[model samples]
Target chain A: MGLNIKPLADRVLVEPAAAETTTASGIIIPDTAKEKPQKGTVVAIGTGKKDEPLTVQVGDTVLYGKYSGSELKLEGNDYLIMRESDILAII
Target chain B: MGLNIKPLADRVLVEPAAAETTTASGIIIPDTAKEKPQKGTVVAIGTGKKDEPLTVQVGDTVLYGKYSGSELKLEGNDYLIMRESDILAII
Candidate 1:
């Protein structure tokens, strides 16, 4: 769980939950029909901006908007870089 | 500026900056060429979450991403409802 890239200013780096590969009845899900994951584990955090410290922390599981955050690949791992407010709920 | 719609959890209501109607040389811009405005004034804000309180307040001039927030028409005026974190900076 280490990366050279670090988020800055209220941004967060999240490791998205794995997309569903199979359905409840064991039907294989196709890539085209798969939806972007909405949940993830916080891997890294930015220094909350001046006068606005973020409430989320490393290792916190969070829910985010379907289109929230920019996608990035760091060290062969996919990550989402989004503002702290993009997070919907802490689960 | 009042609206009946209230944003939920960490959301904020924004009144977008006026689109450019004329260029420096006084050319009339057409509606199709208008890009979504990136700056706005906060009209309303949510109470934030249990532990995470929002830093942006009503009347705060703020910057946001091009596609951030959902557009809504209230009382014949347009507004955007976005999570507080969508705000990039307060001016």
Candidate 2:
């Protein structure tokens, strides 16, 4: 699964994980209780700022701010576009 | 007035403008109606990232996001510290 759109200027393209429907303890979570997933997989990354190269690579699973990134749909697939700084950590 | 602290790594120290008390039309705005000011004067700036030098300078008046910067008080004066990228424009 590859995207044709490329992120620019330290920005990245990410595919968000599906919302969790069940907790680790096996408790089912209702639709209304589902929060926006903060985890995603990097699909693409920018060339970075002049001297700061990106630490994340394509295929890296990362955590980001809940409100970070702009949502967009390409070919019916949802993705987020945000600066690398918006990513909190790689997992 | 000068502060002892220096902002680091693209961060900038700012003294925010006072909230609006009156509109341009002479209507007085109540405290409860006052919004956070988005304009401020730069007090100090970081050395910037390895290759991206900051565009703002000390004493420059800048416009930033209302929610941008962290609030702090030093020597009985309130200030905000944020990344230079948080600033939207120079005014």
Candidate 3:
């Protein structure tokens, strides 16, 4: 069994591997692309924290980096996004 | 003038571009390395937020991904890491 963690604090619940494989310009990305985008879906989100309170919520589709958040497997599915700090942008 | 932001919440202050260029084997890293490591120093830290309290402080060395964290240029030198979530591991 994997972690059934409810991310604490400003952490977010994201289903990793949700990003589009192609660029916005409709260019099918090749494996050699220098900058790769990560795709994920927001499953759950933590309550707002200190000054920089939480802005996004569950079900929001987001994009992150390949090496951003710690890896986790839940119910046989891979997911991540425990902290809001790791998020580069909301999009 | 650039942003001298005091990161709010669980965000940590990290001096980007601080990771070692070589691996544990001391092999010189080639540019073609798939998992490229980004190096930086922790310059400042933010107060902890929510349940996941802040675990790091200023001046601590850290390592992150090249595509992680928002980019910033302070005083003619490039720097980043406004959020602790972006940090992959504390080295």
* Chain A TM-score values, per prediction: 0.78, 0.80, 0.68
Q: lDDT winner between 2 and 3, please give it.
A: 2
Q: Candidate 1 residues B1-91, lDDT tens each?
A: 5567678989999998777554332322233332322567899899987877788889877656668999998888899999876765554
State the DockQ of every prediction: 0.02, 0.02, 0.04
Q: What C-alpha lDDT does candidate 1 achieve relative to the native structure?
A: 0.71
Q: List TM-scores for all candidates, in order.
A: 0.45, 0.44, 0.42
Assess the local accuracy of residue B27 in candidate 1 as a C-alpha lDDT between 0 and 100. 22
C-alpha positional error of residue A47 in candidate 1 after TM-score superposition, expressed in Å: 7.2
Instruction: Estimate, for each residue in B1-91, the C-alpha lDDT of model 3 and write its tens digit.
Output: 2234345455554555534567564534358758755666776565666577776667676666666654433344445545677776666
Q: In model 2, what are the clashing residue pairs, if there are any?
A: none
Candidate 1's C-alpha runs over 4 A off are A1-91, B21-37
Worst 10-residue lDDT window for candidate 2 chain A reads A23-32
**How well is each residue in A14-63 modelled by candidate 2, as lDDT tens digits?**
88877776645443434455453387889888767677899999999887
Q: Please identify model 3 stretches exceeding 4 Å from their true place.
A: A1-91, B1-4, B18-33
Error of 1 at B23 (Å): 12
What is the DockQ score of candidate 1, to 2 decimals? 0.02
Predictions in order: lDDT: 0.71, 0.71, 0.58
RMSD of each: 11.8, 11.5, 11.2
